[model samples]
Target: MPSSTSTSVSSFSHHFYTLLLLSVLLVAFFPGAFHYLSSLPFAYLSAASSPSSTHQPSSDQGPTTTATNTMSWFQKQFSLPPRSRGSYLVTDHVASAVPEIAQYKVGLLNLFVQHTSCALSLNENWDDDVRADMSDALDRIAPEAGPKGQELYRHSAEGADDMPAHIKSALIGASITIPIKDGKLATGTWQGIWYLEFRQVKHTRKVVATIQGEKA
Candidate 1:
């Protein structure tokens, strides 16, 4: 027969370990329940940073729901009509083209222009003068092929403006990435997307939009 004192001591030990395990599990699953849980253990903190903490499956097994998946891929394409030489606001165009952009609660939208003579940028969308001014500035940097600034390069095989267009394109870039949040683009209120055309003749432009992240 066990002594009462031994039984009491065994019960105490069991309760102590049970409470400790409960504490760890509580902090691991519902961290917000206990404010002081951060002081508990290293194991709990490590679990918080684990990959599974946030990443959710992107399967279509159920209706699309908002989630911050560690990895997923959603894509879209935009074909804009003729835009004259200059920087133009395409925020609405983009939104229309990618209507499903709002499905993502948190993610990233990457814009890539297929043409080599154009660029994509994020800038002030309100003022038209800003676009014109930016166009003037870029043109000054890589002016069109002319006697005053540039002599159409040999590569002007495309056109007198083609060489400078390539220079301007390099100066800017062909792609941009913007974050997504709350089913909308996470850009500042004053920020807007722009399509910069560096060519003389207007033509249909194609932009590929690649979205990846948590779907809402």
Candidate 2:
């Protein structure tokens, strides 16, 4: 009986040593795999305690609502009616041409004339006299003819108004920026956009309107 028990004990010890040797060989051959396996529990704990994970909505709370994109940009080109030399109130014309301006809640409206002989400005809206006076004032500033009724400039290739038109356009600028609020232009009660045409003959003009803001 004693001999049989000793044989069984020796067999169990040999099997245990074989298993330990195999495990050691596997670890030596695949150190990176063993390391990754050993670090899995620690990585999981760190991720669970991270700020991003803390902010995540609970699964029991159902699907989360996505946020709306606030920043938006819109641009469109439109044509203005033909006009002779003058400063005309074009607020209505711009609004009519770019109806997309009404989609913004708070933003900026930029109106850019595509012509060099015309300018865009902000000025008085009410009286027709203001427009007339502005035209006369610009004519005095940059006249088509000299004091003796002679050609004053050399850049009259287009017409007598060519050089003077360019000068006036430069002085007044070809673009105007206005604030928009509640999907409407926020100009002052007396303020309006002005389109200054420097040509003697009537000519149609093109304008590019750009809007940047949050959508309503």
Candidate 3:
């Protein structure tokens, strides 16, 4: 029979080997466990690592952390239905096509008109006369060629009104930016978007709508 001292020594050695094997297995299977546990919230690993720690936050003062998504970016392209050679109020129309913009709590919504003969702008929303006035003003600035016997432009490959259309597009601009808030456009009470159609004939237009911001 083994002596008491020898038996106790053997038992101690077996326990030590068992513990060492367990530790090795843990490290082998979970190489990053230490880092992951360390990075966890204090309360997560504190109970086992620090039983007497008084730095624990109370129930009421529990982690005030909130889950938030990382800064995001999204873009989409949509077509603007064909319209005649006149400035038209299309604020709601564009927004309707891009429901994703309404999902954003705050961000900048951008509209880029791809056609050179058509452009985008911001102007009065109410009163139809504002659109008429803008159309008349642009006409005066870059009137369609003909009738008056004025062939002032050289690029007539498209048509008599084509060159003036390009000029008008340049004047109005090809894109516009609007602030989005509360899942809707933050346009002024009287502000609206305008798609300036410089071409005499109607043609389908494509508008690239890009929105970036936090979701509500």
Stretches of candidate 2 off by over 4 Å are 1-50, 53-68
Per-residue alpha-carbon lDDT of model 3 for 95-125, expressed as tens digits?
Answer: 8899998788899998998889889999988
Q: What's the TM-score of each model vs. the native? A: 0.66, 0.71, 0.68
Candidate 2 structure quality by residue, lDDT tens digits, 1-216: 579889999999999999999879889998788789899999999988877833767789988756766789999889888999988998998888888888999999999999999999999999999999999999999998989999888788898999999999999999999999998999999999999999989999999899999988
TM-score for candidate 3, please give it: 0.68
lDDT (CA) per prediction = 0.86, 0.91, 0.85
Q: In candidate 1, how many Å is residue 30 off?
A: 47
* Per-model tally of clashing residue pairs: 3, 0, 0
Rate residue 150 of model 1 by lDDT. Answer: 50
Give lDDT tens digits, candidate 1, residues 1-216. Answer: 999999999999999999999998998999886866455677787787788844666676655456545656888787976887889889889988998788887889999999999999999989899999999998778766565655856787777788889998998899999998877888898899999998878879999999998777
Off by over 4 Å in 1: 1-70, 146-152
